[model samples]
Target: MALVRVQNFAVSLDGFGTGEGQSADAHFGHAGDRLHEWMFTTRWWQPGGSGGVDDAFVRQHDVGIGAEIMGAGKFGHPGWHEDPDWRGAWGPNPPFHTPVFVLTHHRREPIEMAGGTTFHFLDASPAEAVDVAREAAGGKDIRVGGGATTIREFLSAGLVDHLHVVVVPILLGRGVRLWDGLEGVERDFQVESTSSPSGVTHVTFTRTTA
Candidate 1:
């Protein structure tokens, strides 16, 4: 079976995965690009970018990933369902080069983009969505590209096999936290953390009990 993974997910030290006041204008809400600053500095994001530890970790986000399942928040801003023309945040050629299943209440027709990326909307639970993505993955790994709530739901459902969380030093006192209801979730996985020079900690949870 293909493994289910969450890669390059960044959160603040206070555990907020994203800040409040999310809108079409602000994707990460009040947090802005703070959570992803380390990623943006990596060579994986652009030419001549840092080729150090941060780059190494960011590079793995798409490795062996055949399909991606993302929440509506990650797909678009809030109330994006109302905008029929909203394809996604990513431009014409999305980075995802495989079938991308978007979890949303307002299901829409599959939109094939310039690249191999095709958006398929589904109103399904984490397990159901994973099952659908796994089939489309063709035996490759499936990536759970997320918003805080989406990752939490998958974590609560025990559907994730590997989790890569980048803990940024900043603290967002009140926002969408990643570890809200996930108490003692470390027990299921052999947790490991590697601190980068950029002051961000890369923590990985590889399922040990699975």
Candidate 2:
């Protein structure tokens, strides 16, 4: 069966996904690339990168994923909708080689980019968007690429089947957090974790509920 998943999402010790002050120049905001430094060192990111547990887990991010659902914030910086020429931060060929649904109130026409990625703007709830992405996935898994808010919504609605998070040992005093309003969320999942020598922890939440 096809599943809804969140993969390779990096968060700070304080649970912030991306720090404050997001912009075109700062995709990760003030926290910068610190949150994802662990991922960057993985062989999944580069040929000479680490081939340990981090690389193994990061490599699974693309496995069986045929379509993706991401928040507007993940798609672009604040006020990106205002720019007519803005094609996203990934340039011509986005890393996601599948249909991408971007959640936002201000919906725009679908954009077809290089590779198999196509950006489709949607003004829908997490469940509704999942339904749409599930169809596009053709029985393959649906990936929820997030900037915090989007992942929280799907988790709150009990729509996520699998969640893989990389926890970096840092504190972002202020930023968009992934754990707000999600108290006691571990009750629904089979949680597992492994620490890497690179000072990062890979956490996976497999939904146990039917």
Clashes of each: 0, 0
- Stretches off by above 4 angstroms in model 1 are none
- Which residue pairs show backbone clashes in model 2? none
Give the alpha-carbon lDDT of every model. 0.93, 0.93
Candidate 1 overall lDDT versus native:
0.93
C-alpha lDDT (0 to 100) for residue 177 of candidate 2? 91
Runs with alpha carbons beyond 4 Å of true place in candidate 2: none
Go through the candidates in order and give the C-alpha RMSD of each one to the true structure.
1.0, 0.9
TM-score against native, each model: 0.97, 0.98
Give candidate 2's total backbone clashes.
0
Per-residue CA lDDT of model 1 for 1-210, tens digit only, reads 689999999999999999998888888889999999998888888889899999999989889999999999899988999998998988999999999999999999999998899999999999999999999999999999998899999999999999999999998887898998888888999999999999999999999885
